[model samples]
Target: MNITLAQAEKAIATAKEKAKAIDAKMNITVVDAGANLVAFGRMDGAWLGSLDISIKKAKTARYFDMNTGIVGELSQPGGSLYNIEHSNGGLITFPGGVPIKNTKGEIIGAIGVSGSSVDNDHTVAEAGSKAI
Candidate 1:
Protein backbone atom coordinates (compact mmCIF):
# COMPACT_ATOMS: atom_id res chain seq x y z
CA MET A 1 0.00 0.00 0.00
CA ASN A 2 1.06 3.56 -0.67
CA ILE A 3 0.08 7.02 0.48
CA THR A 4 -0.66 9.59 -2.16
CA LEU A 5 0.05 13.25 -1.69
CA ALA A 6 -3.63 13.98 -1.11
CA GLN A 7 -3.90 11.39 1.60
CA ALA A 8 -0.81 12.77 3.30
CA GLU A 9 -2.26 16.26 3.15
CA LYS A 10 -5.53 15.03 4.60
CA ALA A 11 -3.71 13.38 7.49
CA ILE A 12 -1.77 16.51 8.26
CA ALA A 13 -4.92 18.59 8.15
CA THR A 14 -6.76 16.30 10.50
CA ALA A 15 -3.82 16.23 12.89
CA LYS A 16 -3.63 19.99 12.92
CA GLU A 17 -7.35 20.28 13.59
CA LYS A 18 -7.09 17.87 16.48
CA ALA A 19 -4.12 19.72 17.91
CA LYS A 20 -6.05 22.96 17.76
CA ALA A 21 -8.94 21.34 19.56
CA ILE A 22 -6.58 20.50 22.41
CA ASP A 23 -5.10 23.99 22.48
CA ALA A 24 -1.77 22.69 21.31
CA LYS A 25 0.68 23.83 18.71
CA MET A 26 2.15 20.77 17.07
CA ASN A 27 4.47 19.45 14.45
CA ILE A 28 2.98 16.67 12.39
CA THR A 29 4.51 14.28 9.92
CA VAL A 30 3.37 11.53 7.56
CA VAL A 31 5.52 8.72 6.18
CA ASP A 32 4.76 6.09 3.58
CA ALA A 33 4.99 2.33 3.94
CA GLY A 34 8.63 2.46 3.02
CA ALA A 35 9.23 4.80 5.93
CA ASN A 36 9.90 7.72 3.66
CA LEU A 37 8.54 11.15 4.33
CA VAL A 38 5.31 11.98 2.52
CA ALA A 39 4.15 15.15 4.21
CA PHE A 40 4.91 17.35 7.20
CA GLY A 41 3.58 20.45 8.96
CA ARG A 42 4.61 22.62 11.89
CA MET A 43 1.92 24.67 13.55
CA ASP A 44 2.75 28.21 14.40
CA GLY A 45 4.45 28.53 17.83
CA ALA A 46 5.28 24.83 17.95
CA TRP A 47 8.52 23.86 19.66
CA LEU A 48 11.39 23.99 17.23
CA GLY A 49 12.99 20.96 18.88
CA SER A 50 10.01 18.80 17.99
CA LEU A 51 10.42 18.99 14.24
CA ASP A 52 12.89 16.09 14.08
CA ILE A 53 11.00 14.26 16.78
CA SER A 54 7.79 14.45 14.74
CA ILE A 55 9.47 12.99 11.68
CA LYS A 56 11.16 10.32 13.75
CA LYS A 57 7.89 9.42 15.37
CA ALA A 58 6.32 8.76 11.98
CA LYS A 59 9.35 6.77 10.88
CA THR A 60 9.34 4.82 14.12
CA ALA A 61 5.71 3.81 13.59
CA ARG A 62 6.15 2.96 9.90
CA TYR A 63 9.29 0.99 10.56
CA PHE A 64 7.71 -1.15 13.26
CA ASP A 65 4.10 -1.13 12.04
CA MET A 66 2.95 -0.27 15.56
CA ASN A 67 2.22 2.67 17.80
CA THR A 68 5.30 4.20 19.38
CA GLY A 69 3.87 3.96 22.88
CA ILE A 70 3.54 0.20 22.76
CA VAL A 71 7.06 0.03 21.57
CA GLY A 72 8.15 2.26 24.40
CA GLU A 73 6.41 0.05 26.93
CA LEU A 74 7.94 -3.04 25.45
CA SER A 75 11.38 -1.54 25.35
CA GLN A 76 11.50 -0.13 28.83
CA PRO A 77 14.31 -1.11 31.13
CA GLY A 78 14.15 -4.87 31.77
CA GLY A 79 11.40 -5.19 29.13
CA SER A 80 11.63 -7.54 26.16
CA LEU A 81 13.10 -4.89 23.94
CA TYR A 82 15.16 -2.99 26.41
CA ASN A 83 17.46 -0.55 24.66
CA ILE A 84 16.00 -1.30 21.25
CA GLU A 85 15.49 2.40 20.72
CA HIS A 86 19.22 2.73 20.67
CA SER A 87 19.13 0.87 17.40
CA ASN A 88 17.91 2.21 14.02
CA GLY A 89 19.63 5.47 14.87
CA GLY A 90 17.30 5.90 17.84
CA LEU A 91 13.47 6.05 17.96
CA ILE A 92 10.75 8.14 19.48
CA THR A 93 9.39 5.51 21.85
CA PHE A 94 6.79 7.74 23.47
CA PRO A 95 3.25 8.29 22.26
CA GLY A 96 2.16 10.35 19.21
CA GLY A 97 2.72 7.94 16.38
CA VAL A 98 0.21 5.68 14.65
CA PRO A 99 0.01 3.59 11.54
CA ILE A 100 -2.26 4.55 8.67
CA LYS A 101 -4.19 1.60 7.39
CA ASN A 102 -6.24 0.89 4.31
CA THR A 103 -9.65 -0.81 4.17
CA LYS A 104 -7.90 -4.11 3.64
CA GLY A 105 -6.15 -3.70 6.97
CA GLU A 106 -2.84 -3.01 5.39
CA ILE A 107 -0.65 -0.26 6.76
CA ILE A 108 -0.29 2.37 4.07
CA GLY A 109 1.59 4.92 6.08
CA ALA A 110 1.99 6.51 9.48
CA ILE A 111 1.30 9.83 11.20
CA GLY A 112 3.20 11.52 14.03
CA VAL A 113 2.56 14.58 16.17
CA SER A 114 4.76 16.49 18.60
CA GLY A 115 4.90 19.71 20.63
CA SER A 116 2.29 18.64 23.17
CA SER A 117 1.78 16.24 26.00
CA VAL A 118 2.27 12.64 24.94
CA ASP A 119 -1.39 11.89 25.44
CA ASN A 120 -2.46 14.90 23.45
CA ASP A 121 0.01 14.10 20.73
CA HIS A 122 -1.28 10.54 20.54
CA THR A 123 -4.82 11.84 20.18
CA VAL A 124 -3.81 14.16 17.38
CA ALA A 125 -1.94 11.41 15.61
CA GLU A 126 -4.97 9.15 15.97
CA ALA A 127 -7.13 11.79 14.36
CA GLY A 128 -4.75 11.94 11.44
CA SER A 129 -4.54 8.18 11.16
CA LYS A 130 -8.30 7.89 11.15
CA ALA A 131 -8.57 10.46 8.42
CA ILE A 132 -6.49 8.22 6.19
Candidate 2:
Protein backbone atom coordinates (compact mmCIF):
# COMPACT_ATOMS: atom_id res chain seq x y z
CA MET A 1 0.00 0.00 0.00
CA ASN A 2 1.04 3.54 -0.61
CA ILE A 3 1.58 6.14 2.05
CA THR A 4 -1.25 8.58 2.62
CA LEU A 5 -0.63 12.28 2.50
CA ALA A 6 -1.27 12.53 6.23
CA GLN A 7 1.26 9.83 6.98
CA ALA A 8 3.73 11.49 4.66
CA GLU A 9 3.33 14.78 6.48
CA LYS A 10 3.85 13.09 9.81
CA ALA A 11 7.01 11.54 8.49
CA ILE A 12 8.34 14.91 7.38
CA ALA A 13 7.50 16.50 10.72
CA THR A 14 9.26 13.78 12.68
CA ALA A 15 12.26 13.96 10.40
CA LYS A 16 12.47 17.70 10.85
CA GLU A 17 12.41 17.25 14.60
CA LYS A 18 15.25 14.78 14.47
CA ALA A 19 17.27 17.04 12.20
CA LYS A 20 16.80 19.91 14.57
CA ALA A 21 17.78 17.76 17.53
CA ILE A 22 21.03 16.96 15.77
CA ASP A 23 21.61 20.58 14.73
CA ALA A 24 21.32 19.58 11.11
CA LYS A 25 19.62 21.40 8.31
CA MET A 26 18.21 18.74 6.06
CA ASN A 27 16.45 18.14 2.83
CA ILE A 28 13.91 15.44 3.44
CA THR A 29 11.89 13.51 0.87
CA VAL A 30 9.22 10.89 1.28
CA VAL A 31 8.06 8.67 -1.56
CA ASP A 32 5.12 6.32 -1.83
CA ALA A 33 5.29 2.61 -2.47
CA GLY A 34 5.30 3.30 -6.17
CA ALA A 35 8.31 5.56 -5.64
CA ASN A 36 6.41 8.76 -6.27
CA LEU A 37 7.11 11.88 -4.30
CA VAL A 38 4.60 12.24 -1.48
CA ALA A 39 6.16 14.95 0.58
CA PHE A 40 9.33 17.00 0.88
CA GLY A 41 10.91 19.56 3.15
CA ARG A 42 14.05 21.67 2.99
CA MET A 43 15.03 23.26 6.22
CA ASP A 44 16.33 26.80 6.16
CA GLY A 45 19.99 26.94 5.12
CA ALA A 46 19.86 23.44 3.77
CA TRP A 47 21.99 22.72 0.72
CA LEU A 48 20.29 23.12 -2.64
CA GLY A 49 22.30 20.27 -4.08
CA SER A 50 21.03 17.86 -1.47
CA LEU A 51 17.42 18.22 -2.64
CA ASP A 52 17.92 15.90 -5.55
CA ILE A 53 20.00 13.54 -3.49
CA SER A 54 17.20 13.23 -0.97
CA ILE A 55 14.67 12.40 -3.66
CA LYS A 56 16.96 9.81 -5.23
CA LYS A 57 17.59 8.28 -1.84
CA ALA A 58 13.87 7.89 -1.20
CA LYS A 59 13.30 6.34 -4.59
CA THR A 60 16.24 4.04 -4.19
CA ALA A 61 14.91 2.74 -0.88
CA ARG A 62 11.40 2.13 -2.25
CA TYR A 63 12.75 0.67 -5.47
CA PHE A 64 14.67 -1.93 -3.54
CA ASP A 65 12.37 -2.17 -0.50
CA MET A 66 15.44 -1.90 1.73
CA ASN A 67 17.59 0.75 3.32
CA THR A 68 19.79 2.53 0.80
CA GLY A 69 22.79 1.94 3.05
CA ILE A 70 22.30 -1.77 2.58
CA VAL A 71 22.40 -1.17 -1.11
CA GLY A 72 25.58 0.78 -0.56
CA GLU A 73 27.05 -2.16 1.27
CA LEU A 74 26.44 -4.60 -1.56
CA SER A 75 27.54 -2.06 -4.12
CA GLN A 76 30.98 -1.79 -2.70
CA PRO A 77 33.88 -2.90 -4.87
CA GLY A 78 33.69 -6.63 -5.67
CA GLY A 79 30.31 -6.86 -3.97
CA SER A 80 27.27 -8.47 -5.62
CA LEU A 81 25.66 -5.10 -6.29
CA TYR A 82 28.80 -3.35 -7.36
CA ASN A 83 28.03 -0.72 -9.95
CA ILE A 84 24.32 -1.20 -9.34
CA GLU A 85 24.00 2.48 -8.58
CA HIS A 86 24.76 3.10 -12.22
CA SER A 87 21.37 1.63 -13.10
CA ASN A 88 17.82 3.08 -12.55
CA GLY A 89 18.91 6.55 -13.65
CA GLY A 90 21.14 7.17 -10.62
CA LEU A 91 21.07 6.17 -6.97
CA ILE A 92 22.44 7.44 -3.70
CA THR A 93 23.82 4.18 -2.45
CA PHE A 94 24.54 5.51 1.00
CA PRO A 95 22.98 6.16 4.37
CA GLY A 96 19.97 8.46 4.87
CA GLY A 97 17.41 6.35 3.12
CA VAL A 98 15.01 4.02 4.94
CA PRO A 99 11.86 2.07 4.19
CA ILE A 100 8.64 2.99 5.99
CA LYS A 101 6.63 0.07 7.19
CA ASN A 102 3.13 0.03 8.53
CA THR A 103 1.91 -1.61 11.73
CA LYS A 104 1.40 -4.75 9.72
CA GLY A 105 5.10 -4.76 8.92
CA GLU A 106 4.40 -4.04 5.29
CA ILE A 107 6.46 -1.44 3.54
CA ILE A 108 4.36 1.58 2.63
CA GLY A 109 6.99 3.98 1.42
CA ALA A 110 10.41 5.42 2.21
CA ILE A 111 12.05 8.49 3.65
CA GLY A 112 15.34 10.11 2.66
CA VAL A 113 17.35 12.83 4.34
CA SER A 114 20.36 14.76 3.12
CA GLY A 115 22.32 17.95 3.80
CA SER A 116 24.27 16.50 6.71
CA SER A 117 26.58 13.68 7.67
CA VAL A 118 25.36 10.28 6.58
CA ASP A 119 24.90 9.21 10.17
CA ASN A 120 22.67 12.14 10.96
CA ASP A 121 20.84 11.71 7.71
CA HIS A 122 20.13 8.08 8.49
CA THR A 123 19.04 8.98 11.97
CA VAL A 124 16.57 11.53 10.72
CA ALA A 125 15.26 9.19 8.10
CA GLU A 126 14.82 6.51 10.72
CA ALA A 127 12.87 8.88 12.90
CA GLY A 128 10.61 9.76 10.02
CA SER A 129 10.00 6.15 9.04
CA LYS A 130 8.99 5.29 12.56
CA ALA A 131 6.37 8.01 12.65
CA ILE A 132 4.06 5.69 10.83
Per-residue CA lDDT of model 1 for 50-80, tens digit only, reads 9999998999999999999999999988999
lDDT of each: 0.93, 0.95
Clashing pairs in 1: none
TM-score of each: 0.97, 0.98
The digit string of per-residue lDDT tens for model 2 on 21-103 reads 98999999999999999999999999999999999999999999999999999999999999898888999989999999999
Model 2 ranges with Cα > 4 A deviation:
none
What's model 1's TM-score?
Answer: 0.97
Error of 1 at 13 (Å): 0.5
- Where model 1 places Cα greater than 4 Å from the true spot, the runs are none
